[model samples]
Target: MSSAGPSPVRGGWLDPRKPFKDGVRPRKRQLGLALRDLCRLLHSDEPAETGRRPLKQAEAAKRLGCTADELSRYLNDTRIPSQDFLERLHKEAGTDAATSGQDVGITLEALLSLHTSALAERQGCEHCQEMSGRIDSLIQQVNAPCPQCAAHERRQEVRRRQLRRRQQRKLAIRLRSASKEQQTRLRLELAEVKVTVADLKAELAGKLATEAGLRERPAAAQPAGAQLPVPRRPGDRQLSARDVSAARQLVAQAEELDGSGREDLAFTLLQRSTAELLTPAETALVVVQLRCRERDRLADDLIHVYGRDQEKQDVMAVALELHEAGAPNDAGAVLRAALG
Candidate 1:
């Protein structure tokens, strides 16, 4: 005892109540969590007004006059509802001003503010840091793992490959078409050469016969190069370059208008483009499509807005008449199907 080594000091490592600085703080409370709590309270099996007879999601959506998907978003979305949505929801859910947490003395908005302040206080306190970290760790443990979208990416890759194949096939077709056109030109040139040779041979023979006849009788009054030229095909008329350029402009305008959601205006421009650029037959087909689409809209409007019950029948009669005429693949059939 007399020779005891100085005063025995016990100083190993001891865990303090406070945590170290620079640790991850607890996550802020999410609106989804708040909504989840409310939904649980509303749909609780025990001590709820509905009790054992719980309202199904579909039935609740039906009562609310919205889709079940929409109901899920309204009740479970992480984002706070807009003021307009809140008021509309208040009306739909029959949550009165008195019961919307003001009179009940418990409000989600107020609770959120209070919780934010409390969390801030804890985050600033060294003594509470350990508790915050523990709670965050536990919450993370309860979270579901993220799902991978690799299958979707694979599907997109397949679609892109299909598109590339289609484009390649189209390019091959165009090359084949050009080759066929070149072959056709070569064949036509060969035919022209043969015809020229035949003409030259005939001329030589005619000259020889003429010379022989002239030598014998001094009169052979007939030439063979006086044949009339054959006429070309009926629709072989070519368009001038100027006309094509004008038509292209109209088509560009039509596409622009279509992109802007002015389909009616787009139809007008397309009609103009066809009228200026296309043959009569091509124009007729375009007109058929436009008229058919318009006829459907007008027919429905006549019945609903104008109260003209016979308008559809009248339109059908006109279409049938056109079909009976040589226009059987006719605008009328298209119109009837569209309108009906």
Candidate 2:
């Protein structure tokens, strides 16, 4: 699922869990640098064009197979994304990780922390190599003439086979669902075309088999003057080129933050930047970033007004205090509810 848009931080605290899962530790400097870079995107916003929809957090969590809390934590800056998560983001969002400054050169082994020193390099944890080496030695012993691991491997293989079958079945179900949706859209388009042909036949006053009401016919089948698809009267503001350009630039800024070091800032900025125009969702982001996020005092004021929630106002106040005291996450969620 797509991130609600934008990066929150440049690089202060890389989610320790991400690199650990990848087997690498985040560099402190890299984390700090990144946070600083991404914080700038918090400053921009514009309106939206019709038909561009953003994925909600609940939907995103469901798609990612993560608990909403887990998704929120990752999103709300409690958890940093793993390499796998980043790959998923790139694949799903049509976002180029490199453009977002996610081109870290941590190797497959380093990325996975397969080597002891790799752990040391990322985490500054002393003697990770010794720990990795010990694990390796244990594996070696397990595979020796004593051999419990061989039996274990055979059992694991069987479980792996069962899991693969389960995955295939699920994939087939999803593919069928998607196919059905495509068919529905195609059918609608065809029906629309057929109505157009019938209307033309009717206009020529040739007897044609057809339904008799204006509302019953597809708008496209009506005479040229007929209205279609919620006819745009005046004041349907379309987004301009400058607005689109700002969004692109903001996206780049957010990415640089992800790479440079401030992920929290990147996440926040990403949210703000992605929705330049306001939706209920965008308004929510603005409300969160502008009124609530006191932690980023150095942060520009992006929100316009507060909707009436005493708890939200209180939360915002508390959050700002936390940020002033250097606790950003606490401040961020102070306003963003546990759900919604």
Candidate 3:
């Protein structure tokens, strides 16, 4: 006789009817089988009042406020239903048994105990299994307080606090790095501003000396333009001490107007002063002093007017100095435009 390839198996892999020691049936599978049987008995036949046939899986899920697919998963041991679903199922089973005049042979407490034990077993934690047993005992004894419940809640709260602290530490580290980058940028800007201010102060002093020298000249030897009225055309450099003083006062008033939120008026006044009262270098100095938003425009105009070979060389030197001083990108851009 031919030898049999292998003995035919009595059951498939994971047979629910097998004993626990056989290792073929797990607690979850057992729970799923029990729930499936309960639902089958509950939805077996319609009541006399309804005069309808048994409900389909979809209709049963609709009554339980769940989808057919979710019900299928719960019955197949592929997914665990929530505690609320278990409680609701137990109540429905009791109602069905009462209507049909038959016993469900399963209590709400017993169902819940099985569900908890199944979940604890799935986690493979001895502590969880112990807690599940303690909780189950308390349920059977009605109104009995559980000491371990408070301790479990406290441990969860401590873990949440530790996680929050770690997130805060990460955020603080990022902020500190950002603050360092900002400080470095501010320091570079401050140095550039200082260099520009020094250059402006020198130009203003030279203008002052020229005005003083004009005053020392004899009346007959003085330039004819000096005798002209205020508000002269551009390039008329014969400004008297009074005219210089008046121009300075006008700039001061413009600064006040700007500070008072009248920027349009201040800008108009500054344009008039630069066009008629002050020389190119003096205008540049005032623009720097006021820290005008239109400083780039005014600087560009000055660069074009200072068109002689020597003046162009001076512009180049100033641009190199500002670049070396680590001026901000905007300031450096203006200087580069002047060079071109």
Candidate models: Cα lDDT each: 0.42, 0.42, 0.56
Candidate 1: where are CA atoms >4 Å away? 1-148, 155-159, 170-174, 189-201, 204-340
**TM, every model:** 0.24, 0.20, 0.30
lDDT of 3 at 265: 52
- Give the top-scoring candidate (TM-score): 3
Arrange candidates by TM-score, highest first: which order?
3, 1, 2
The parts of candidate 2 lying over 4 Å away from their true place are 1-145, 206-340
Error of 3 at 316 (Å): 99
Q: What's model 1's overall lDDT? A: 0.42
lDDT of 2 by residue, 1-340 (tens): 1143354433423232333223223332233223222222112112563433334446555655666666544433324546575444434433323344343333234323332243354565556646755766897877677456678888999999999999999999999997687556445533443454344335433321222344567777788886533422222223234333333444444445546655545555544332322223223333334323342431322221122232354335444544554546544654454223
Backbone steric clashes in candidate 3, count: 0
Of 1 and 3, the candidate ranking higher by TM-score: 3
Best by lDDT: 3
- Point out the higher-scoring one by TM-score: 2 or 3: 3
Give per-residue CA lDDT, model 1, range 1-340, as digits (tens).
1121122212211111222234322332333333232332222234645533324567545654667776565444322334444334334333422233222223545445434534554457655555656766887866745445567778899999999999999999999997687556445533443454355446545755765655454233334544332222222223234323433444444445455665555554443333333433323333333334444332232223211222453334434434543455453444545455
Q: Per-residue error at 279 for model 1, in Å? A: 34
TM-score of 2: 0.20
